[model samples]
Structure formats: structure tokens, C-alpha cells
Target: MPLFSNVPALRLTLAYAFHDPSSLLPHQTIPTLLSLPLPLGPSLPSLDGTGRKPTIRALVLDKDNTLCPPETAKLHQAYINKIEKVKECTEFSHSAHSILIVSNTAGSSPAPEHEAEAKQLELELGLPVLRQHPDRKKPFCGPDILKYFKDHGVTDNPREIVVVGDRLATDVLLAREMGSWSIWCRNGWRNPAMPGRDYRGFFSKTESRFERIMTRGFGNTAPLPKAT
Candidate 1:
């Protein structure tokens, strides 16, 4: 039996599921669910961008909040520190990994300020900026990232790439579709009301959930699985 054979019925029920919100409850307060931190066993060694891991060859990152805080007041210094940290992490590992910045700045013809920002980021991070135009409805969803890797001659399977970003809708969704692992930086900007609102939490919670789900089917120590 194929999966989703009962999907049609499920969809029918879901379509009218929200027709009567009042019928569900009367001023019911949902209990605040707090996620407990899991112990990082000694078996799980520290990951500092090095280590001969069996997976994740490339690191694709989002610039805005994942790398640096989004505060205009301290963006410059924060960015510089982020760059240094990235360099240190990558160099310490001594792994021949490629770093790419996938960002949503202006479109092809970015404003003067946007251009300047991109240039600054590029210089600081020592990586090329793959800025997607805002007008491009699905900026990251389009073939921008895939085309990037192809153009750069990255023939490895999508599973070999890891995407780190702040937003779940953009970064996580794109990674899922492309079959790439994703690291959601909890300190960045995010939308908590979306479908996966549960994911928006303290860094510890997000990291713990991510580790739990990814390690489920794979071996215990397997590098986190790509989000789907």
C-alpha cells in the first residue's frame, strides 16, 4: 500500500477543521511547554568545523542573523567577529570545505546601500555573496542555490551540503526540498506563529530537537540529518 492513500480523507477533514474555532474550547490556556536540555554524551565530540565526519562537506550560511546579530547599532563589529570565528572554525578543522553565503538582499539590481552591504559582507567573510533579489518571489526557493553549486562545479549530492540560517520558512524549507541538512540558529530572527512554531525556542531547545529528530533513523553519532 502506498503512503497517503488516506490523505484525501485527511485533507477533507482538515479543510473544514477551522470552521468553528469556538466549538473547540472556551478560554482554554495552553500549558507552556518547556523543552529540557539533553546531555551531550562524551561519545559526541565537540564539533568545531573540523573532524573527519562522514557527512556534510560544504557549509552554506545566511548572513543576516545566523552569522551576526541583526542590530544595526552593532552590526559592523558583530560581523567582523563572526567572520573571524568562521575563519577560525574552518581553518582549525583544516578541511577543504567551501563556504557560501545565501542571502536575501535586493534583486540583481540592488540599491546602492544593498550593494555596499553585500560588498562589506563578502570582504569580511572571505566568501562570495549569493544575494537573491527580493522581487524573485521565492528567492532561495528558485534554482539560485542549486545553480550556484553547479556553476562552482560542486557535483556532490545535496546531502553533502549543510545550510545554516535564522529563518525556518526560508532556510529550513529550502534545505528540505534540496535534500540538504539545516542548522537553525535560534538567536536569529524568526516567526513563531508559523506551522513549525514549536521550533522557535531557546538555542538549547532548538538544538536538542534537531539532534533528536536527525539521529532517529541514522546511527547515534551520525552528523545531523538534513531537515525535511
Candidate 2:
């Protein structure tokens, strides 16, 4: 047998994931989600006028309120069409560009449940999904998602990859650490900005007009916001 054969069963265990707060933009900036440039340009070290305009070739997204309500395990009713359009933007050649869901669910849920949920997401989205392995919760689990990228031939080209999420600490920091593009999407939940602040909220088209219209879509959320 080779040094390491195929993967083996993962032992159930408590997991933890961390992010570098200094590496991320302020969490409050997410309120301006739709205000940022679409398909964010690559931040690679500039080479005088190589002028290869960067194109977004891949996306790594968060799970919870970013795509669906917490633990609903399905695409949010509102995001259905918007996600499809975003999918179109990430597509290259005949196949859709890789869109991965990387989450730190190990601390919160058992691995089996997370795996099942990820499978459902893969079915609905027609893309890949990655979650913390039962034996390895993030930051250790981060390698699992990265391994999938490596296995699938995702390159080190930062211009071609992105990570979108609701939290700046985890998602943004992950992007920074990985040297990939970052896009933060905000919802009515999880405000780490206000340490002790307590409030409840709901999302509706009337209030979340941007989400309802999905103006921050590819090419649309340029200098002038456009919608599909």
C-alpha cells in the first residue's frame, strides 16, 4: 500500500475555527455590500502595464444568512435567481467555474449533518461544497476546502479566485490568507461590530431592496449598480 491510502473515517470531535481580525476590513463595511465594485480586481503585486485585466474565475461562499437562513439547509427563497446569475458570471469554457461553500460548522454541528447539508447544496447549486471534517474543525479544517481546490486544479492565481461571506473576520481573513479576492455580503443577522448590542431583524424586499433586486451582481455592481 502507498504511504497513505485513500481517506479514512473521520472521528467525531469538537472543532474550532479562527480568523485574523487584523487581516479583514471592518465588519460594518458590509452594509455597503452592493456599493463595491463587482468581480473585484486582483490585488497582485503590480507589474508595469502587463495590463492583463483580471477576471474572476472562481468563488468560495459562506453558508448561513449569506445564501440561506441559518440551518435552513436550502437556498434562500430570495437568492434563488440571484445565485444563478452569479453562477453565470463565474462560468468559463463550457463548464461553470468552481463555486465552493466553505463553512466552519464543526464547532456547531456534527460532521454527518454538515456533510448531508453540503450534499443538498451541491445538488441544488450544481457545484461543489466543503465543510469541516468531523475530526478536523477549522482552522485545521480550512485545509480540507483548500485540498478540494488543489484536487480540482484551482491554481494559485489570485485573480481567478474569490471568497464571499457575511463575516469579515472569518471570510475576509480567509481570503486575505489565501490571497484571493474578497466580497462581503450582509444580512439582518450576526453583527459582531456591536459587542453587546441586542436586536432582532428580518429581511424583506421592502427593506432589503438591494438583495431583492440583486443589483450587486456581476458587471452590474460596477461604478453604477445594475441588476439582472
lDDT per residue (tens digit) for residues 62-139 in model 2? 666466555556554345555666666534322453677776551224557766787787788776666555544332
Against the hidden true structure, what lDDT does model 1 obtain?
Answer: 0.44
Clashes of each: 2, 0
Question: What global local distance difference test value does model 2 have?
Answer: 0.47
Worst 10 residues of 2 by lDDT: 9-18
TM-score for each candidate, following the candidate numbering = 0.51, 0.58
> What's the TM for model 1?
0.51
lDDT (10s digit) by residue, model 1, range 88-157 = 5532233423567666542223667666766776665566666665543222343666666667665356
Q: Looking at candidate 2, what is the lDDT of residue 135?
A: 48
- Residue clash pairs of candidate 1: 107-133, 181-226
The predictions' CA RMSDs to the true structure, in order, are 12.6, 12.3
Please give the CA lDDT of all the candidate structures: 0.44, 0.47
